[model samples]
Target: MTLTQHAAPPEPPAVAAESVPGPARRRPPRRGPGLLLRPVFLGVVALVMLVPLYVLVVNAFKSQQEILTDPFGLPDGGPTFQYLDRVFHNAQFDIMRGYAVTILFVVCVNVLSVVLAGPAAYVIARSTRRRYRALMVFFLAGTFIPSQVLVIPVVYVLKVLGLMGTVRGFVLFETVLTLPFSIFLYAGYIATIPRELDQAAAVDGAGRVRTFWQIVFPLMRPVVATMVILNTFSVWNDFVNPQIILGPGSGLYTVTTGVYAAVSQFSTDYTVVFPTLLLAIAPLLVFFVFMQRHIISGLTAGSTRG
Candidate 1:
């Protein structure tokens, strides 16, 4: 009979409704002085770099009156193409012609330099002999010598050879000036490439010329592209060399010299000067835009290989 009060079936084991541990608290968004300062630093840097380009573009569109009145302001109305028109029509025609000559110079120099330097670089990289090493060091040391320092000597030599004032003369000078660096860069890159590739080619009956042209040359496209772009820009923009060697009214002015001549002659004539400047820069801009991918690729290739 038990005074067993029917214990109510122990309340169903207390169901725990909540998780044993509360939900993880998200970390407070990190805030530090660096985070605040970074954007400001970047903005300042961007502003500093952009100011000159902004001024150039704006001044190109402005009349002399506008430029003098408000050097830093936006155009009073819409931008005008008058300066551009004048430049295209008259101010820079000769300069544009010079640009064409520069293009020719660049192409020739790049092709010749690459052809000569490629083999030299390959040999220097693969050779273990002390004599070849000494030669490589000599070649590299030449790069430290300033071209300007040699100008007088070069002119004298060219004069002796009766090659002055000729395109061929300029080509020869540039080739010599540019070759050392090209060879150095190529050698560094070639050193990183496995010699086994060359050995394999030779084993398969590929001659040196054939192996280089078919195998090595293809692999070097990025470096070649970089060399072309660099040499092209240098040759195109070269003012002092062309100015001194080509002389005035030689009809052989490069764009840089042409623009300089325009500026000197016109002085404050913005209509002429702006357009000339614009035209002078236009080719470089176009080239950079078009070849940017290749340039970037070449840079990456050289960096990684070296």
Candidate 2:
């Protein structure tokens, strides 16, 4: 009975032939040149960028003789604050006044740009009308026209409007210049937001403007931040527009113009040139350090979403 009941011993499961260890697979050799290339290229690029900054910083603390003798060298003695102090107190160009005036212009331009561009972008983003699309094209067209080209025409227009050489005129013109790109950025970003949010807000008795400001505008902070930083840089660093628009005759000097005024007279005076230049850029450098992440994220998010 036991012999009858005993089944043939179960056969072992067949092993996959591929599972048998083959010759050790060889990995492709990494190219030594390719491996070293990226870091080497980056190092070269870094050197190129950092050399000027290094010179600017080193020379700022050194005297005229030290700068000329060894522009690239570290200060032999301890760094001095005298040059910076002189830059601050320069009677010919008040650095504090220049900062105040430039800051004011930056604030005015940002506020005006946001106020004007926000709603216009909302309409352009939501509208199906051909006219709205045409309006968008018009704004896009403005971005292609160089700000330098617009300077002469803008000056003429400002003069006709009795606003030339005035702070109001300068602020207004800068705001106008910002609108095209601001709207373009804003509209693209706004299109990425869900329309259901707008409908929900409307159902709650909110008007289009209210919905946009309260609901949509809050979501647009990233793009808006990107725009604010860009505009700040543009307005802050603009030498040509301010130099011409807020001419010396007007007694209004932005940081850049004041730098020109202080440094132009003493072009070869490293003591004056380096220090003033350093002071002028210090705030912006600090700002960029903090805001650089926002700039990259905002631009990338908008671009990716669009």
Best TM-score among the predictions, by candidate number = 2
Off by over 4 Å in 2: 1-36, 303-306
Question: In model 1, how large is the Cα lDDT of residue 101?
Answer: 82
Candidate 1, residues 150-178: lDDT per residue as tens digits? 88898989889988888888888888888
Residue 246 in candidate 2, Cα distance off native in Å: 1.1
Provide the lowest-lDDT 10-residue window in model 2: 1-10
| Cα error of candidate 1 at position 202, Å | 1.2
RMSD of each: 4.5, 3.7
* TM-scores of all predicted structures: 0.83, 0.90
Clashes of each: 0, 0
Kindly list the per-residue Cα lDDT of model 2 for residues 13-50, writing each as its tens digit. 99999999889999999889878898999999999998
Give candidate 1 regions above 4 Å deviation. 1-45, 91-93, 302-306
How well does model 2 score by local distance difference test? Answer: 0.93
Model number with the top lDDT: 2
